[model samples]
Target: MRKWVFLCLLFLPFLSLAAEREIRIGLIDTFDQDFYLETFVPTIEHIQKTLKDYKITVIELQQHNLLANVVKERPDFLVSSAGNFVTLISKLGAQQIATVSRNHAYSPKEAVSSVFIVRNDRKDLQKITDLKGRVLSATEPHDFDGMLVGMGEIAARGFDPDTFFSKTLFSHYQYPDVATYVKVGAADVGILGTCQYEKLLTTGQIQPGEFRVLEAKNNTEACIRSTERYPDTVFYALDTAPIDEVKAVSLSLLSMPKGEFDFEWVPASGFLKVYDLMKSLKLGPYEHLRETTVKDFILSHQKELLLAALLLCAILVHVVRVNWLVNRRTEELKFALAVQRATERKARENRQKLDLLEKSRVISQMSSIFAHEVKQPITNLIYYASALSLLLQQLGVKDDRVEYALKQMNSQAKRTSDIVEHVRSYAKHKANRSEVFNLVEVIRRAINSINKEEIEGVQTTANLPQEAIAVGDSFEIELAVLNVLKNALKAAKNSLNPQTSVSVTAQKHMWKITITDNGPKISEEIFSALGRPTSTSKKDGLGVGLSIVLSIIENNGGHLTFRRIEPNGIAVDLFVKKKEE
Candidate 1:
């Protein structure tokens, strides 16, 4: 009887020490009531079963109220998703110790991904790069695990999540709203969490295969994640919490059973994954988030913090001033280098112009000599051919030879005319002169100058407007027109024997004049040569006519083109931009 009484007295204090102290677990209401009833209850039951030694009570509250109650209830532990965990830890001085990885028939983690959901029919969305500059719908920007991790994956591939997306919206009130925004096409791409997408599919809010992932980045860890797997729901230690208790909880989470739906607890680095992501993606705290209003700055920084910030700003200004001087000197050097480059460019251009002028002068002098020398011979040939034609007519020759002789005489006269025209074109002056003149009237005059005899064997037509006008040297324009007309006549004479025609058409548009011609087809090789200073015809050619034409046209801000007229002919087009009107 004495031994039993002594044992009972010794165990009395121990029994009082074992009496249950309250251990409240705060759960953020990230899910709706249905999910809380179905998923949360079972999960809480398991937690309670595992922590049987303490009087554990799980209190579910909305994220808005989680912080308030943390001060009121002072929970011994907190449980939330990776995103809510960040806010709770930051605001309530609570910590996250474990994260649940769900793997079930409803969601196969092995095939899970952060889906960049777009319309299945959009071919432009073949790659992630195509999503740049497109509007996106997502969760809140602060929801690191939900939107930011996926956004970081996009940024890693060279797209600026903030800028590449033309607009960003947080339409999801919580996890369930993602499917509605995507299904309605409110955005080009809707970013959603893996489990959230499953939930959406299960609820019939979204259809499978209706959306295709634009750019999928896979993460290992049994889930075919579309984004890098962030260290989820990291556990943080309260400043006042016993370090031993925190360590004990962390060890328990790590030592949990290895299974597909297992939860893992690792040491809480307080959203280090998010911090790293922000740094890599150049977003959030890692980026310089500009405070647009003074109120915004004040709300972000308290009075003491603001004072520290002001001192920091002063130091930053000093550093910035020093950097500014360095940059200014560097820019001055750059400007000097740019000026030197400009001088070199000007020198090169001037040299090229001088060389072109020298060549033009040499060609001009040679052409004058050739024209003067050839004029007498051409005149003699014309006279002799005319004399022969008259003799053949007087003989009344029925022979084919007589007819052939007359034909030869006509050809010789045409050759003489061509040479005279070339000489005249080259001899025309090309001086810088600006004057407003009717472009239509100038073209009509040039077409009229096309001799009737040249068009005798072929039909010729002209189409031109009556009121089109331009500002430039009229003399140069006239010379260029004549050269083009002469070339057209020559081309028409080649393939078609007496029935071929050349058509001249002019069109006017705002600040433009277009003259098109139809003649015998010319190859690109020959056409390219036509405007070259040294280019020429195959027979009896000096090559200066078209050269002079190009020179004059270019000086007046015009371009010349000789292209094939489809199957069998050529068209010479002259496009001039009117200087004034």
Candidate 2:
């Protein structure tokens, strides 16, 4: 009895492992099999612990054998680049579940970048164009960032690396090999990922400044990059995989504890950018297949070819006859059109002259009437205000209210005269003189022109670059700025705490000035009416301020747009072309 019990105990451990459910995962041979094993063992162990019944088995697949293995074995899941994921989804119906977020020194979790390097001592190799006729070393052709993206960068600069280089060598298994080749003078240039280069430096395999990063980019993330960034590796589930098991494994991977692996699985990031790269290179999902040629078509379908040729000849004859008939009809129509056009032109000229004379006569009469009618009202108001002021002085009127009323009367009379003068100037179509000037100076002058009382208690801020020079009528631009400022002030006054800010950004070809206000939201109806002539939402508004502003902006080759801000407010963007140096 004791011997039998010992035998049962000895076999129990093997029994447990044999009963454990197996979940196979396919991984691209980006790194060697040992590296993947070392990196993913912790993740697999974690998944097994979380779901005790299931154990993960990682299967390394070469690029050439990747699709074949997936089709033959049908692994439950996969780990590969975004480009490969797109290809698999299209070719094998695989679905992406998660993306690997590599925690490298210079790479972001969602994307990676490639760097082109040459020996630092090689001053002749200054740019991508300089790589022409030089020996180039790269990883496998299908390597996304390491090989393909670098080729795209060179191709964009009008150099085909394959033909341009005197010799091209590929390191099939490891990217580091390319760097080593370039370092030892075996190759003039090499391509590798930024992370891999940094790793080589940290490990003392490559010295600092041993290789120069060619065509270095000024990336905001401080990453050493040469080519445009692309999305990181993807973790996907096959269509044949069990949904429940896939979900369990996906959740486990996403929530897995972070340790020495330096990477974690996050939800899938978009792969359209990768898809675009694939299409541009004619690889992966966009791979160019063998197209049928004329010879092949004829050999395969002799009877169909004969029938097609006869039908084509018949169609050509029909087309030629139709074209000849069309030409004959077209000539007849042209003659009729010419005669009709001549008659219409004579009639239109006579009508236009008559209309112009009538308009001139009407305008002269209206101008005379307006001048006569408006002069009498102004003269009477001025006379009455002067008399009232004299009477108040002579009578020794001690009442402050009486004196104030006289003062207001005089002010109104002067305002009436200014309006009349302004109308006359507008009717005369006054020309605007344009000159190049700094926009910041114009904004300051406009702000100073506003009544201090109108902007009282409003917190205002301006963000302007040192120089935003533009060519336009300074007076007109200032007037537009004043009108926008006035509207923003009114909006600010309506809110609990009034705050307005102006931000200026200089773009490649234009300057963008944005004014934001914190106030009650403008209704859609009122917003839609803005920018139209004689449109306003204010109760006592003349509805001409924004109209004039719009006209001024449009006449000066600028654009203005209004947007409603969330939680209450408005933003106005003013775009103007920068002055050419």
Candidate 3:
């Protein structure tokens, strides 16, 4: 007894909870409200019998008051036709819990369909198309079985359901009214839901031979239908419904015996067919789409709009990327140009130094030539003066004017001789082969001379090989190398990142000294007349430095040549007779 009491206590709260649970179910009042209780009371009683402790409330939903009542009454579940269920599911977040199958006559999904009815004697209605332009009796277009099914068939045949019939009597689309109207000749043709004809015959309200189904379609149903079948009615829940209680209600409805009622609950079937029907007719959930608006336009042209947006984004990205690349390249080009200008400036400075060197060399050459020539002439004059003085003394023909003239001539000749000697001493270098020195050391001297000017920003590189002995005057070699280096540096300075390079490579019979520069290419005229006095790049140049350098090198058993460097530069090669070890 104590154990029994404990068990009861444990179960007591659940029973009380069940008793306190109040459920409200909304029913779409598509049927006549007068017969609403008779039509739905059995189903409600079946539910009440299952949940004996729970209180269930019923709410009738008129078509005009569907959304408003659903919001105000807040029903836990909804029972309605498939079309009304679709509307509620879309607008109120309702989900199908079970489908209604009438008397186990058809599957839940393919339960109801429409049929065309005509009198037996109406031979004129041999086919559905024959009824075109004839009178049609049906409910509103929204009625799934009464009208939409048959209209859907007409539409499937590519006929406009609205215009296929010349005239139509529209109403609530009650099946019996359609049948009676057809029988009485009030309507030439009629539309009915699946199995309504059999029902009418069972009630003896119509004779079998009195009517004939037009174009009956063979399907897996107990009733003859002229159109494809769609799901019948559905039981669904709103967002506010308790899932556990809703499931209990579903189980109860499914378990309801196929008693006196025309319908029973079954497992939920696919409602997509109904949605398709609505789409074909442009009714129900698709009704708003008939109006023209931006939202509707977007919904209709969703793919096109999405593709256009993507293409636009791609173009924007491509443009942005291209612009960024162009900016980067422009900046790079600017930097490169600035560097080039700077290098060219430095080159000009070096060329100025070379020009100065050329001027000094030419002036020294002229002075040496003048001194050599005048030295002999002045000595001859002095000798002549001495001879005249001696002859006058011997002949005893002495005069004060002649003596003064001789003295002046002698003094002037001596003074001129001294000036010539000074110039000759300054211009000449007495280099002999006995002074055997390293050719590399001679190049070092030439570089040292160039460094005296402290030239900046000109890169000079020299490759010195092992003991490149050359049989020549070191001084002349040094001078020649120095001249070549100056020329290279001058040319190289005209470029960005100026480079002047000297390389010495020794052979068995000769040693090669090559100097290269990265500068403007040598002109053909300048190259052809190289090592000769010709037109030079300098405004005041007589091309004397390189000429003197060539002369000196030839005098020392060596020769030099100038050639162009590929791309933009010049190179000089000096082949000196090597003093072999």
- 1-581 per-residue lDDT for model 3 (tens digits): 99999999999999888765988988876643322564477888889899876799988877775688779888899888788888777788888888867664557788778889999889889888888899888866556667777888887888877689888876564554777788878788988776777877989988879888888876656778888878877788887888887878888887988766567777766688888877777677877757768888999999999999999999999999999999999999999999999999999978966976787687788979999888898999999999999999999998999999999999878867865765575488543354567888888878876774534678888889767767777766776788788878877888988998999987668888999999887678667778865556788666667877786777777788887886689889998887766
lDDT of 1 at 249: 53
Candidates ranked by TM-score = 2, 3, 1
In model 2, the Cα lDDT at residue 447 comes to 82
Model 2 is weakest, by summed lDDT over 10 consecutive residues, at: 101-110
Error of 1 at 516 (Å): 51
Query: What value does the lDDT take at residue 182 in candidate 3?
Result: 84
After best superposition, candidate 1 residue 409: deviation in angstroms? 79
**Which prediction has the highest TM-score against the true structure?**
2
Better of 2 and 3 by TM-score: 2
TM-score of each: 0.39, 0.46, 0.45
Per-residue lDDT for 205 in model 1? Answer: 75
lDDT of 1 by residue, 1-581 (tens): 99999999999897876653445666665543444555455555555666566566766655555456667766566665555554445455655565544443122112223667777767777877778888788875555555776778787887766677888878546643555566666787877765666666678877887777655554334333466555443334454555655665566555655433344333433356555566666543344553358777678779878799899999999999999999999999999999999999999979867876777788878767777888878778878877877787788756788668767777866656665655655565534566888777777777776788776666566555556667776756776877777766666677554223333344453233333334556666776666665545558776667777777777777777666654356565666556452
| Model 2 steric clash total | 0
lDDT of 2 by residue, 409-497 (tens): 88768756755554454446555566898998888887887898988989999887787898887766777787898889889999989
lDDT of 3: 0.79
Rank by lDDT, highest first.
3, 2, 1
